[model samples]
Target: MEKQPSSRLGPLEKLRSFKMEKQKSFRLPGSTSFKEKKYKESPGKRGDMMLHLAARAGNLPHVQMLLAEAGEEGAKDLVSKQNLDGETALYIAAEKGHVEVVREILMVSDLQSASTKANSTFDAFHIAAKQGHLNVLKELLNLFPALAITTNSVNATALDTAATQGHVDIVNLLLETDASLARIARNNGKTTLHSAARMGHVEVVKALLNKDPSIGLRTDKKGQTALHMAVKGQNTGMVLELLRPDVSVINIGDNKGNRPLHVATRKANINMVRTLLSVEGIEVNAVNKAGETALAISEKSGSEEISAVLRVAGAVIEQQQPSPHPPNPAKHLKQTVSDIKHDVQSQLKHTRQTEMRVQKIKKRLEKLHIGGLNNAINSNTVVAVLIATVAFAAIFTVPGQFVEQPTPGYTLGQAFVAQNAAFIVFLLFDSLALFISLAVVVVQTSLIVVEQRAKKRMVFVMNKMMWLACLFISVSFISLTYVVVGKDDWWLAWCTMAIGAVIMLTTLGSMCYCIIMHRIEEKSLRNVRRSSTSQSRSTMSISMPSDSELLNSEYKKIYAL
Candidate 1:
């Protein structure tokens, strides 16, 4: 009763065969595996220990087996083994969020001695918190709640690490168990609020401050507070949040004798300056250690926008006095003349650039305007031809048919005089609409083909004529409807006329709305330009695209708490 041979091998057998096979018996010696070969290059040790690799790979069963094979003392030693980086099984498990493995390691390792283990240089709680693993952090804290107060080698507590990485939940958990951990400083004397703001995490910054507002006042090694870091990070949201609790930090100086305003101006951060100016107690005119104010630095940096903002906030620029020890009169006069010539040349060059930019813009607009005009003229020609055909056909086919001329003098439909008046009105309006629309088509075509010199002026004149023709066409359409149904039912005639009026209004309203939005965009662009230096238009920004672009970007410039 022997079994038959299988056609395919199982995975375990395949893997075992792969491990047993050699490259080629004649080529070199028996080849080492890539893992063994790579480890041979390092000589003394493999990269990660088997225990650490099993823990990192989430192999809870293998980890338990390894510990079970080893007796109590041997399993304790295995749990305490470390990799080259000094990270133990618990540390790697905690970092990668392997909860059961971490629990096993914690259960085996001596708790009191393991918290300060020589093999693992870093705190396991800090690693879990920094990596945003709430479950592993909870397990670690449960095993040794005292690890919450322990700082890593870098002197950063779990709370500070969590806040820096934007782990809001982890920070909250650590803070709940040990409320005093919020005030503990990292290596540089900076609190969690400083790290949160520096990392551009507004929610984390607010959360850190909610537990302890005084954390915002603690300065870093650079002698700057959370507001300073927020401004430096160019995070408008974080800056506003930090300043909301304490506006006094707005004027506080750093070790380099730079206030937040000075640093912002040096970096040419226009939004940062705007936020600082928004506060009521901000001293805009206060000078730095160099005896220069934010306005002075902004002026020197050629930031016209920031300078204008500072001036609007009542920042008075100090006037420079002439040197008392003046040079020789003739030498000074010669230097003044040279300076004047240079200024004039710079002004002329800037003016030429401005005119060229304007010409480029006009050319682009002309192309778009001409394209729209051609489309309109083409569509209007089709409509005009249709209207002309209908009008000519109506002249012959009157609403009420003739009755053999009615004895050679009486007009047809004489019994219905009001209906005859309606017919006459329709005929006159229809004729006028046809003629005007036809004329508009001819004029617009001629302007597009031959009239190139006064094209703008001609287009303007043609636009007005096109509107006039549209007005006549609308009136004629309503009159024709009235004539068709005047005697049969006057109510239907009035209803159609009202509907036609509504259609006309809707068409005109769309064009009006576009014009209004464009004007708003123009007004904002003009405001931006107004802050630029009068002596140099080169500093002015390009015109904004549309109202919506301005609205969306408006938040990037300012965010009030």
Candidate 2:
């Protein structure tokens, strides 16, 4: 009865009412509908579900159907929405390699506007190229060729992504589309050619250069050309490949002003150095920001191989002098003197020489720091013997829970005199050894204390000696266990004792060695500090003479040095 009134309405009246309702809906607040639109467009689980279904079904028809309704429709427009991670419909399509589906969507009139702001402006093309999907890339490029140079959020173009990932064919396709992409740089100023060269993708690199020859030696943000990354990676084969006849090796410098030679020198690779040096137009005298040449770094490292290589390349090894002037003269100097005196010059030269010496020692110290302690401990045969003795003592004398009573097996004559006497003698010797082992341990500890206090170079050696003592005690305990506890069940007792002895000895020896090495390091650091302090004090105490008293004050400064 209530619906009867509406059923009676004429068709013209119904059409007028429908028009009024549609107009009212359009009149609703922009903020309300816009917010709802944004939410629906957001890439969430729902968006992912639709995409999953579309991809699995390879349903270009459904995707096309959804795309046709985008912008005007609410939920269906979400197909173009960004996910939580900012992946868009196009990104998903390219990732899935759904070429037909991607083409259908791209063909839409609002294709460009449909792109989500959260996405890399380059979108699906970059993802496809990065993932090495050639067919998808061709489809996207066919639709929009300018996407070749379109950048990601990081300003990486599709060509850059392809080159970085070593996607050879994709790189080739992009390069062919826009030959200028070879020169177009990212925010970091790295060109696609730079990425391909660094990754050692020879075919891709050649193709890019063949497209545009000027990018052969372009540099990145740090001023590192493709050659620098190649050398640093120690990709010798790639390095060789990039060394085209026209490649300018010398002109390229990294952030540190280091050419390829500097990298080769630090790597201590003679062959790499030789290869770099052989390059045409390479500079022998080029210095890094530190004013250090390849030869200087090689000398500082004391690497004979690298030094020899540089020397062959006519590298000049410049000697650096220390600063004669005090770091904070007012704090140290009693009086001010004018002018650069002879004493000041001499002091400066001495400081410089000392600095050079310290640098050389530091290089050697690093090598020792890594493995010296372990190697020294293993080499000391006496330390090994001592550790074995201590381990034996622990295993034999440190009594365990007695599971059974000892059962003696011997003839009356042997048992009464020889065997029993031998047991007594063994006991006596074991006691003496235990006492001596304890004494050794005490002595070693005392030595460590002395070294820690004295801050001497010999402290390392002394610490090593202490470790040897601890090892001796540990081995003695292990040996005593095997010798004394095995009167019954000789085989089993001896086996356990042997294993225990080895473990105890090795552990104690290793610890001792580590402690000794650490002490040595401490002593070396202290010596360096002391030397620095003395040098500073000497520089400050002596004043440079004025035009009036040049000889008297200056002579004193010289004499002190």
Candidate 3:
């Protein structure tokens, strides 16, 4: 006869050889030699016996053979034994969609305590529903109709689990068994309908809503209804379904007083927005806890698409406000004062910042202008010195040489003119050019004598003087040409003078263009600064009450002092 293996020297011996923090056992069915630790730590990971493993693997013959080896008493105890997760073999077979194995196990397992032990909350029916095993679920429900009310560890009934998984048939079966199953709140007071809407399960939502029409409006602990979840989930189909069932859901606010429309606009959900607006009974202009309507929220988010949709749907803008329901006159007055103070402070802060920015630009431009002035002064001084030199040399080197002896009625300066009027004009203009050029030099050298404020103006003055000196020099040359060429084609000299005038005009136009370009750049900078200031002001929005509100509440005291 073969000796029975001891628990210590059996297959458990392999498990005991390792240096583990906790001792574990792997006992076969009906074996009593092994010790008992807490069952929470089951053998190995799956903790499946030959019966449970056969049931899970869907080997019907293997399961039946294992059942035969364990007699009727041993088989019932074996089928009822739990695995690591406290699920029985019957529960495992049902969860895996092994309906044949489930039925066979149900014939022998403890139907009363299959998953209803004090330690287990998940039953075969709940597992079947969650796993979408319809045939197994029906069989379990047929045998034990009371399992419909069983909740999991989180107090979720079979209907809640089915709705959460979007198993429509399972949900219908559970709800048909017990209509009250639709109303159970699990996992933070969320009804099954809330779960379905949140998961975008349109069919599941419809089924649950048909079962209990009031379930559509039931809010969770956070005050979120099925409609709120639908909007938040951005499920247009589910949203439309929810709205048709209960149009009053349009006005029901979440914990933040935000209606479905408000949430849709916040999320910029255009499809949901369209669905909500199509319903005539919706409160398009409902205010949230922040006293802002859906329209206001869309505009604030800069979602013009949603805003336009809401506006065309006749969603009116809320009267901008401190909420009208101010609790008392004293708070009203205090709030008014506080709001005004905040607005003033915010505006003053932005104003100061804008002014500082403007000042910085002005200073930067002034520095550039001052730097250009220094260079202009130096350039003009060089031109003036050259002009003075040429003019002085031309005085002696007249158009014609002086007579060998002094010619009668003519000095050496007038010898070239021969007392001709053109000659005299030439001498006079040459003297004028020389004197003007000298004066410009003096002004450029003595620029420091001018006051700081007037120094900038002096640049304009000196620049004009230099141009004048050039004009005089040109005019002098034209006069000399007339004297030399003597009454033949005097208009030629005038043509030359006109050409000089055109040159000066072109120079002036170029200078004007530069100044205009500089001014345009400065104007553009100012515009950019103003744009930034406006953006800052918009971002720093004041939550102040409207003036109308302040007048109606603060100053319009109801009682006399």
Candidate 4:
């Protein structure tokens, strides 16, 4: 054996080292090992090895030689083979911008099978458009025109991708191939114009608009036209281009009712806001679905510059104004009915509260009256006992001395002045006081009434009895005073009588006056309550329309219609 160079590197290692050495000066930190990792990670890369390598290197001669050795059936199989990255040789060739290699592979192989997508979900056509390989894209489209309209996993066509990448030539080429491509939207309802406008692709937007100017009016899923998307970008030129086709697009509302001006104000883009406002016939005061105008949105966002621009443009928040047209009678009737319903509900609520308050006051007064009755019962019991004791003692200890022995017409234990007129008066009055006091005490102790009404009635009767007992007791004391002073000092008794009469009559008259006034006040309160009840009934009759009136109104509405 000839002397061979001693090397420990394997074939795969040799390939990585060769690639690394060739790219040493141009290599970034992690760029050299990418191919090595790709080879190591994918066993499928080992299949159809020469074709993938030739395609990756853009070696047209090597690819041709390999395809020539493998006949037609074998060449198709080799071209259809995928690496671990799911990329076919054609896909690699297209990605590397090898237009000849891509054309060679597509020539003998099935166009669909040759353009099979890799694990990245993009086939040769999409990769070519994304890589801006205009020749490769033209070749793919010429071979397979259906690939132009075909969507990816995201439902984005090649034209959409081209527009997104801001490739104005590719967009123009795709639109020329198929002008309808401008109308095709992605899954998000964004067309090529929307993509171009949002990405601030001024040339691409102009090309798309040149193809179909009406495409600018097409709204996305958000009801946002290209004008709306264009303002979101910083490019005011794109906005002017979009508005050039249709100025009314500035006033168009999205699903949220936000116009371009409103959107610009929200983003605080002063330049965008000014551009939108400068356009003639722009509806600066247009209110959105949320009832917020552009000025309102600007003020809320605290964008003073935007607010000033909008103010200069005569943007005002929309307010509710009375309609100049006559109101519809049916609608008016419905509103009147609603107002009446609300009023009736409120009035009923107030009436119920008033009744509840009246019941509360009545219960509280009854409680106070019961408390007073109980207090009176206790004090009356004590007063009756004291009066009874005084009356009984006065009868036995008369004003005159009692006769001790039987003599002439006098009897033992009899009062000496028993036959006197004043003595008789004292006896009669003392007996009356004693019996009345005893009766009052008996009634209080005997009655054990439990019901509130019956208890109150019993207390009223006992209170009147006690009042009589007090009056009789006072008369008895006054009569005994006359007897004690004797017949010659009868004028002194008269003076005493005068004083007692004045005091007793004054007290009794005051009590009678209080009772009469209380009765008058109670009657007055009753009359006022009756009058109020009648007034409320009359007011309800007037405020609440009757059925006949409602029917007449309905008939009038029908007649007017």
Worst 10 residues of 3 by lDDT: 552-561
Taking the tens digit of each residue's C-alpha lDDT, what string does model 3 give over 1-561? 245656546767666675342433454555543332232223556676666677778999988887776788878777777766777778778879999998888888655755543245768888788899989988888887888888888888888888889999888888888999888898788989988999899999888888889888889888989888888876788988887776888889889998888888888989988988888788777788888898888888999888889888887778555656758989889999999999999998977776676566556555665666677778889999999999999877876676656766666444645577877777788888899899989978875834545765677687777777887888788888886665777788778778877987788677767666656655675686577778779998433333343334313322111
Task: Give the alpha carbon lDDT tens digit for every residue of 218-243 in model 1.
Answer: 89898988888788777887887887
Task: Give stretches of model 2 more than 4 Å off.
Answer: 1-49, 56-79, 113-122, 319-561
TM-scores of all predicted structures: 0.49, 0.48, 0.51, 0.50
What is the C-alpha lDDT profile of model 2 across 361-458, one tens digit per residue? 55555444434443433344345446446545543443332224444764332322223433444445455545544454454444433232242344
lDDT order, best first, reads 4, 3, 1, 2
- Write down the lDDT of every candidate, Cα atoms only: 0.73, 0.63, 0.77, 0.81
Lowest summed lDDT across 10 adjacent residues in model 1 is found at 552-561
Worst 10 residues of 2 by lDDT: 552-561
**Number of clashing residue pairs, candidate 4:** 0
All predictions: root-mean-square deviation over Cα? 16.2, 18.6, 18.7, 23.6
Ranking by TM-score: 3, 4, 1, 2
Cα displacement (angstroms), candidate 4, residue 321, comes to 5.8
Residue pair clashes in candidate 1? none
Which regions of candidate 4 deviate over 4 angstroms? 1-48, 321-561
What is the overall TM-score of model 4 with all chains considered together? 0.50
Give one digit per residue, the lDDT tens place, for model 4 in 1-561: 333433544566889998878878677774536775454224443554768888999999989988886778888887888877888899999989999998999898776785588887888888888989999988888888888887788788889888899888888888889999888888888888898899999999989888898998898889999888888879999999998888888888899989898888888999998888788898778878788888898888788888888888888867455567987999999999999999999988876776676566556655766676677788888998998999999888886589998878899988888888777888888888889889989989998878877876777677677778778878877888787887789888889889988998898777777666656655675686578778879886423333343333322222100
Candidates 1 and 2 compared by lDDT, better number: 1
**Strongest candidate by TM-score:** 3
